[model samples]
Target chain A: MHDLDVLGVIFILGLTCYAMRAGGYVLAASMRDDGIAARFLRLAPGNLFIAFIVGGCLSGGLAGLVGTMVALVTMAVTAREWVALSAGFGAAIATSAIAP
Target chain B: MTAAGFRRGLVAALPFLLSNGAAGLVMGLTYKGLGLGASHAILFSLLVYSATAQAITLSMWASPLPVAAMVVACIATNSRYLLMGAHLRQLFGGLAPRKILLSLFLLADASWLMTSSDADRNGPDAGYLLGSSIPMAIGWVGGTALAYAAPLATNGPLKLAAALLPTMFIATLLPSQWKNAASPWPWLISAVVALLVSHFVDPSWSMLIGGGCGTLVSMMERTDA
Candidate 1:
């Protein structure tokens, strides 16, 4: 085992992230206005956002799941981001406090 | 950028800053625990500017560094940003190369979402994009510095605070987008696939796979319709 060069690792990681971020713009230039890819991009963010949180919520266990449900229901009903977030956080914190 | 525009962006990003800060604090403490110095942690936060990517980097850091493995790991975790940038094509698509470079370099999920939502609701403004980005950069880098200067545990109140962060994206999505969703099947399928992938595959690749699957399904549905 050997300690890696800290700065080198950071540089490579940073460059990789930049490439991924910029690569989208380069590829997007070819996207037709009404193309399938265009439509996909339009709806992809929300779906991707959902996917991003799935693991986090699942790992949080039952409390996390309940909290997520509360948040989703609150958002659906009230359409208020903050209020829904509060409901979710309240559930998570309360559940953690009681169970942890 | 107009002062008002910039201020509005900053205010809009404030709540996100809190969540980002909590995550940053945890990361900073982790770096310290790993025997990395404060300067190194700060540089890492500034350059990478992603809590998830930073976390993956930290986990991947080991003897001999497994540099190739770490690169692949970061790519898998961050492939979402590619889609995010594509989403912004309509907004940043027309800008000069230099301007686009600056904006894309600073972009993150929170800023990208806020900027895109703002464009959809209120029309795209370059200033708004910068407005949203600057605050997030501050929150992320500032949070790391604060945490390195004063380390904090990941659990306890911090854990609860961190727990609350992910749902913000869902809340952002449902308020306006959910009502307008042509069919909920794509999202449902994506979420289920993501859950399954998270269980079987490395969590790092789950989001990209799930998102790709969701996008493909949605495209196919659109074609069918």
Candidate 2:
């Protein structure tokens, strides 16, 4: 592909992504705040987050599982994100080293 | 746009400088391996600005570059943003549209999650949203450029650890998302469904399908209550 073609593809993909990012917000302007749709929006974030973690763990395998557990426990006990992330990183490395 | 809020958000997001940079480095290497020029690689990161979307595009990359398929895959992988944007509208609906839309350009998963948590505690501040988003963008774009300028030979374990950063970041935020007794059931449902979906279908769709199912269960439980 020519440089111009690559640039075009990137530009189009970028626009597509931005459209998705903005589409819901624009569409939600018509939704009544008290409606079921609004309620679903309110309730979706946590579940979405949990699903993300599960998907991540599944892809990462035992190392990912152990790392996430360590991170969750560290977050619970210390309530510090940096600390938990650090602990999780270390645990993943250790687990990866030991798993195979 | 409050200066104080922006500063707090910027400081809070400093940790991602490392996490995002590491991941971005890996992405940078991948692009380089694909034979993309430094400028093209950096532009891809800046424009697409999504690890998932970019990864998907890279998988489908070819001489002709299937433009239609790439666009479809990008939308599918990033459909979560639609839900996130709707939620943000609920939080900052009254804000000026121009400001919100401009800020949306820098929107990212980590920044959105952090901003939502911040809003729950400090109320909606678009400044903070923008501030938090800037570092993540920098880490990603800058890291991609750096990788092209200076390719780093990464080992297996180190790369694995870097890859886990986003997951770890999400895990840390899990505590704040815990609402009450009702939270567990939905969360468990989301996890199990996500695992099942990832196994059977595409892993990419797992989050949306699992999360959507879990949210439906929560809504039903709420109606019953």
Candidate 3:
């Protein structure tokens, strides 16, 4: 492969991601602290990430399902992110190893 | 670049490095499995810094790479950032354009979430944002390097790393503060919408739809008040 080819891909992909992120700020520069809009923005992060997590789990299948539940229960009971995460990771690893 | 900002950012970002490292390790392993060179993996992480985009690119690794398709896929996968950026702008738009632009560079969803949640109490702090981002960026790049440089065993434990990304999200969103903040209905509705849309439509779009609908439900509550 040509050296220039790799650079070209990086340039295109990097620029695209950067543009989408920066462009949103530019477009919304004039936005005021409108009540509804602010509320939406405030809620957006939690909502978006939650949705993304759901989608990620879908792709994860059984491992995702079991891991997520384990993590949720652990977090609820212990309130320790690391512990919850370890439980989830161990479940996923074990499930994948035995099943796959 | 105040010392305080850097310190806070670094501290805030340190916890997330684990999840980011896991993600980067997976990407690195995938690239290595594809037989790409270390330089290729490093460059991809440095430039893209996106697991979804890099994962898609990995699927298309070939002699004559489908460069165009890969670019399209990257853009489509990253479109969620648009909403993230909007959220950030609303929180911190008063800052100088340069600082805001700089923060946007290498911004990850986890950082955005952490920063946004912080903005609720302390106003927009570029220093904090930068602090958090530095460690995360390092984790991603360093994790990729470790994967290639060391060539660790690819067993069930390694594959389990993939699950960390989503679990990280759960950890971030399900903290006691968030749980006590409000009713669970909005989050539940959003998850169901996202799950169904992801099943029927392209999973990428499910994020926007679920978040959009969930935010709308939240707005309705605001209206009722």
Top lDDT hit: 2
Question: How well docked is model 3, in DockQ terms?
Answer: 0.43
**RMSD to true structure for each model, in Å:** 5.5, 5.7, 6.0
Ten contiguous residues with the weakest lDDT in model 1 chain B: B163-172
In order, the B-chain TM-scores come to: 0.67, 0.70, 0.67
Candidate 1 segments exceeding 4 Å error: A1-13, A24-28, A74-86, B1-41, B50-95, B108-132, B163-181, B196-199, B206-208, B223-225
- Candidate 3 residue pairs in clash (backbone atoms < 3 Å): B9-B131, B9-B132
- Candidate 3, residue B139: how far the Cα is off, in Å: 3.2
Reference-based TM-score of each model? 0.65, 0.65, 0.62
Best by DockQ: 2
In candidate 3, clashing pairs total 2
Work out the iRMS of candidate 1.
5.1
Error of 1 at B28 (Å): 5.5
Candidate 2 wrongly placed segments (more than 4 Å): A1-13, A24-28, B1-41, B48-100, B108-136, B223-225
lDDT by residue (B1-225, candidate 2, tens digit) is 788889989999997888788667767876766678889989999888988677657655777877876776577557668777877888888876666887788789888999999999998887898899989999999888888778464457656655665577668767765652265788899889988887776555666688778878988875422
Residue A68 in candidate 3, Cα distance off native in Å: 1.5
Better of 1 and 3 by lDDT: 1
Per residue, candidate 2 scores C-alpha lDDT tens digits across A8-93 of 99999999989978877788777665677656655666677688788778767899999989999999899987689778978998
Model 3: CA > 4 A from native? A1-13, A16-29, A76-82, A96-100, B1-23, B30-40, B48-96, B103-136, B163-182, B223-225
Tens digits of per-residue lDDT for model 3, B1-225: 356766777897896678678657767776666566789779889888876566545544555666765665565456657667777777776776676788788688778877777767676776677788888999898888888878486554664564344444344345542532256667788899988887676565666678667757766663421
